[model samples]
Target: MYQYKNNILSIPARLLYQDWSLMSYDTYKKKCDRKQLIRTQQGKGLGNEAFLSYADLPHEIKSVCLDKIGRPEETVVINLLEPFIIPDSKASAFFSNHRTPEGRPLAEPKQRQKSINCWILNAVQLVFEDRGMTGKMFGKRKTRIWQNISEAVNKLDTNKWNHTLPGAAKRLKEKYENYLKEGYGIFIHKGEGNQNTAKIRGEVADFILSHYALPIKLTIPMVLAKYNLRRLEQNWPELAESGLYHWLYEPEQERIWTLARHGKQAWQNKFQHTLSRDKSNWFPNVYWAIDGTKLDWIHFDHTTGHKMASKLRINVLFDVYSEKIIGWSLSETEDHTDHFKAIKMAVKQAECRPYLLTYDNQSGHKMTRMQEFYNDLVALKGGCHHAHRAGAKNNPAEQLFNRFQQQVITKFWFSDGQGIRVKKEDHQPNTDFITAHKHHLKSKEELSPAWEMAVNQWNSGKHPHFEESRDEMYQHPMSLREQLSLQEIMQHLWVTESQKPITYKKEGLTLWLSHTQYQYEVYDGDGNIDIEFRRKYVGKKFIVRYDPDAMDVYIQLCELNAHQEKVFVAFAEPKRKHIDIPVLMQADDKMSWARDYAVRDIEYKRDKTAFEALIARSGYSPSAFIESQELNIKFKGSMPKKQQQKVDAEEDEVLLRM
Candidate 1:
């Protein structure tokens, strides 16, 4: 069989590999006068059997994924139906043929490889059937498995399979034969040369492994020393000097692994054991991941006054669906207040409440106040979930914080290296010689731009294989308006709640908090805070909400389940004003004198006279009216020169008449 007009294989790739699982095949065929045959022969003629390990495949093939050690947990041989391209051949110039609709040619072999990877999948319709010893030598489910293949072959669509049968067969035969010679494209036996001469017996291999592996890991040298001391393994060469180094490092490392505890000491010492579980949710505002990480660079915490002995912690509330940093807070402590503030910002900015929130079992996340905050705002339609404390595996927020540190935090002028920041090395700040540089440390308030930059960069980065940025994904096209309105969210979910006792004062109700008097105007004129609400909730509680900054305090009488508990009657700051002393100067001095006299005369008479009657008819003496006269004189003195002179003349005339 022979065909060669151009360098193109001109044959269906599948037909060549149809007998791949046969284990052995003998073929003698001629194509272009090149004979590539693999015949099974053992015993005297062949000293060793030519066997290809099913697991290992070259990197050029994407159908198989395996570790560098040439082992796959299970064989993953996807049956591909595509034209085979041998790049070194002349027909390989067809590269530019694969173009986007925009008329852009694909990038070299990688693009072609991706096309193959995308189209090929595990064989679905193909299943091998073996007939028992009774059936004809080797009976299999050939008919069912190759219906499509047979149909395609008979139809012989040149568009689909552009290659001739003999050409495809030659292509497969050549590749297969070359692979066998190359040890199935994987390095099997070594370059050890004479290095592997120090023979290790099976029993000694067991002893070495047993000695090397312990609950607390020992260095290779220490392990080797322990192994030699046992005297069970004799004639053992030093590990480094021994050619078994490669074996000990990787492939046969299991010999050492059996006796060693894998992460045994750390596993024992760890406080929390994490188990993985699926945390996937498809809807927007359905899953919120919250976690906090310490920023590498220091910031001055005025509360403690040391240049941030505890560095600033960046708390993030990440939307898992969009991979967006929806909300964040930079705080001195991983306080529940900061946690609430972060979530409050997210809820208000996102305008939707999360049905489920995931957090780690950190002290901040575990606070009773934090739990209450979630209860009051989160609705718990889907309950709260917590990950194990130490590992960030379950918390996507932690992952985002890692990204934040790398992209945003480490870029700062004062960046101490974010230790866990991946892919950015050699940027870690050295503290040993740089202690005096603490003066260059920025204050907590100064890093406002850094936080903004973190969010901007985080949401602006283009997602892999997608046209949209993280911010675009966050503005989810599929999001539906939630049942809860902004009003409801602001009332319950948007604000932090505090419970405090209201003292009933004759002036007004004063609720003491944080050493500041946050006075509130009673919503109902009936004095609910002092009497009605107080009587019902005295020694009980009421919900108080403040802004994210905690600058404004708002007390509310909320009963969400009862009638309109979702609604809140807000108590705002009492609007205060100074009395208009200028306006009071316009009043008559005679009226002021009469009122002062009536107050004393009325007190002596013990009469329930109306203030209107006293102003019209009361008579008085100088002693009772002295205070009012003095106040009149002071009021007149504050007026403008011309006005004050006129008022003085009138006051003097009034005093003379009296």
Candidate 2:
């Protein structure tokens, strides 16, 4: 027996082997060789030649080798190579002599034989029995009972057993091959290990793809939920609280509301109501309403840098119903002359004589000269009725003034010289003034001039309001006058005059006479007719009337026809009252002696019988009930009859003589 320590073997069998010197020496030599082979096998250098040499060694050497190598290959090699020559006793001796240090016999050949027996047994068990001992049990039983167990142990090991002991080794080899083929049977295990990780990774990928990989068609709520969840997950509480979440929900509507609240209110108060034609109520040639307004007044001189100093007033007249401007004047001063010019323009522009001219109680409109003109017009039956009324309620023209101020005048600031108050002595240009002009030009001259130009351009140019020029709005004066025929224009020139009743005192015959200073004398059959006439006032009225043609007065009834024939008879004045005759006449025909003639007459006669009767009745003599008459009969030509006819010879001679 031997106990191995480190790389050396120790033996207690020296006394038992004292008489076997040669065997002991051979055993020592074989043991040294086996130790060499064991060293070689353990170091990964073993080969078939080393196994054969180990099996052929002597019993004593094999024992020594077994003790030295701690493995039994030499004895098996001896049994295989020299089986016929070696007796069973020597082989048995060889196997018994070999023992491990534990006192068990080192039976290298018998161990090999026993391992073969066990392998054979396991094979028989697998072949004959319903269930065989498992390959693991076979490996354990072979390792416990086998001698020189390297080959038998290798046959039972699945990897080494594949080469020997065909049936059991092949089955064991197949089992291990299938285990490797199924990836170490680890499919379900790997899946179980990674399941939670894959799920979390998939969710993260879905979030990233949803945000960045697709078009943004989601509603605001969806977007909010997505971002909120993400932010919550990301621990960004502050980001989640930003009102940007709500703002993105209604972006367009909120933007529009913001603009409406903050934008300019420039065009809010434009004119709302338009004048309707039905509201106009025009009287028939009676009322003449006149008014004027100042359009834009600037403190600065609009023409030159010279301060206009005074505001320019533009006077305009509205014909109320016509809505036409009858007169207009642009002037710096708001004096009576301005008023007079406006009125004169209106009068000349009126299509018919106005009955009453209504005007506001302006001081400039109440001039004495204007009043005198009104009285003269009344005297001429021109229907001069002047009414000075308050401007508050009755003035439609004042509304127009307000419109002008609101719409046009107040839109611009005037550069009128009223800038900064300075002493008159400092008014002259100096270095400071020059500096002001250079530096403060925007305040000084820019806006006023631009405003003036804009207004002028608006008036003269096409207007958006009327869609016409200011000049075109009221017809051009020349064109309007030219549109009327010559006769119609001449008719417009006729002046009206009224007649008062008058009585004459000559010869105690109460007569109505017209007084006249002599301008022309007509020769009647009784020589030059006197053209002088005297007027006498008989009650509240003139007692005489004048002859328009003879330029003298006769009894009111002693006027005549074209042939020196009497036309009217002198009448006696009534004791109770003197009667007055109503006269409406034109002054144009009496213009030659207009200043000298006290009255003018006009007659509309359509027939010769009326003319002849007036001529014959004019020759009556005056009595106390009537009156004496100094009559002058000078005939003015008569209007041509529309239908001329020739009478018979007798009638023709009477007409010619008459």
Candidate 3:
């Protein structure tokens, strides 16, 4: 405390020191005998009446007496204003007396101290405001927070400044920075609902959160712009009217930053490579690894038996530990139905569902149908990077494909790659393997028997490490059955599957999947359009795997963790089949019509040379030919759509008879 009654308080002349030579010698001798005083008694000597003027006061001591006449750091101003800025409940709790367990007020010293501190802070705030200091510099770095706090603490009855100034400044700096970063909410420990947010509160929060989850990335300005626009469109008034944008930017920095930096894939990879896996959890049926492989061996067209195609899809499922191929399906496309059939076959043969099913990031594996099967069978999942991730982390199916390719595919006929390579060397094209086997198989029923023979041979073979065959290894192990009822799991999880690539049109509110254009409209449980539930899902691609047999499938694009993630969220129906027979037939008919019209138009144009030859062959005289030549021109009301050639007078006279 600096004191001023009628005028500024005068300093005592004993506080001023000069004559350093004599003072230093005396201090050196009296160092151990007395205190090392900063100031020495001057010309006043022992006179108690001698008071020095303000000009005579030391600069360091003069600064303490005078309140700084400039703006202080915002944190210092904030600290000063806290007693008034805090809400009513907090103000009461901070200013009130200490409470007992029974809620009775106690006359404790701590309570009296807080009351004094609050009063002192309010007094300091008034002086700072009088000196033109205000809490407006939020962006400015708080450099003088400690100096202001220290000076204010000394004036108050606080022992906070007992430590060294440097140490006190350092601690104060950290505290102020933390307060700025975390917010004034730190002091009161404000919970979520209790905090004050004028701009980003209530519905504004919902709009910001919803927009931020869009698949496309955005900057804070863009998101804020959206917020402003939505408020304006919704006919809500601007938040601050002046500093709304800056106010929103300053407060929700950390939260907005998190949403901005994230991409669509971030959700899927959140815990990808972090968690550890235990291999001791493995068993015969504990984990069944399944994936689709485009088999090297080409398959013949079912009816022709000689029309071989590029490749056939092989959906294989095997016991991971036993290294046995349990079931496989050969199909033209790697579809959900093919995958379901393969897994069903494997489960039925084993008479139990595997506790876990490991799969690859493939179209068939990621399908909603497969996800449903996965949800029913097991919950545990993990994968690791290794030498050629396909063979190592993947199930035995990959290795089985390699072995099957070597023994069967190469023995009969080389694959496309080998065929080309071998043809270049030998100067001869390879014959089809199905050409030899076609005579042996007659129908789809026979095809299964052929595959069964191959599978039986594969299962009966001795294990590479053990004397027991793959079949023996699979049967001997007593693994715990997955708790789900087989019948219930199959009936509940099996959905009639249809899938296609659907593109989201943010503006059009339509999904362009295949050749069909489907709309995304919100529908209620009764399948009626719900006009109130309108949301715009921006640009992103989704595989709409739907139940093909269902009378109607509802599709809506939702957030990444949004419920029903494992199923088709943003939906697609058969916009048009990939190859619609009727549509193709109609297109072909139109093209044929165009070709016939072109031929008829060409035939209708008569040639002058042919007419002259016909007249010569008919034995018409030169007089008759000259008489037959006639000049005529006619005008039509409307011109044709195509450009007409204008006659060149000079060329027409030379080419045609006049």
Off by over 4 Å in 3: 1-236, 239-285, 301-307, 321-324, 327-329, 332-395, 405-473, 485-658
The TM-score values for the models, in the order shown, are 0.37, 0.22, 0.32
Evaluation by TM-score, superior candidate among 1 and 3: 1
Segments in model 2 whose C-alpha atoms lie over 4 Å from true places? 1-287, 292-296, 299-308, 375-384, 411-658
- Most accurate candidate by TM-score: 1
User: Model 1: clashing residue pairs?
Assistant: 10-163, 10-164, 11-163, 213-260, 559-565, 560-565, 560-566
Residue lDDT tens for model 2, 490-517: 3332211123333222212232212312
The 0-to-1 C-alpha lDDT of every candidate, in the order given, reads 0.46, 0.36, 0.44
Backbone clashes (count) for model 1: 7
lDDT: which candidate is best? Answer: 1
lDDT of 3 by residue, 1-658 (tens): 2222112234343333332122344443353144332222223356433333444444654664354322122112113333332223443465364333224463545444444433443443444464344332111235554455554444332353121212355554564455447532333322222222444554555444434433354554566565564465566544432233333333122223223335313321321111112233243426677777765544455657556554556788878767688877776667666666677677667765566676666665666556655666562333121122443644555666666655544443324333455445432234564556545423433345555666677778776789898878887756455444667544544443334444443222354332344454333454332212212222334444332223255543433332425443543322211122333445754554454334222321222233234333433323432332222123242324332222222222222242
- Candidate 1 lDDT score at position 494: 40
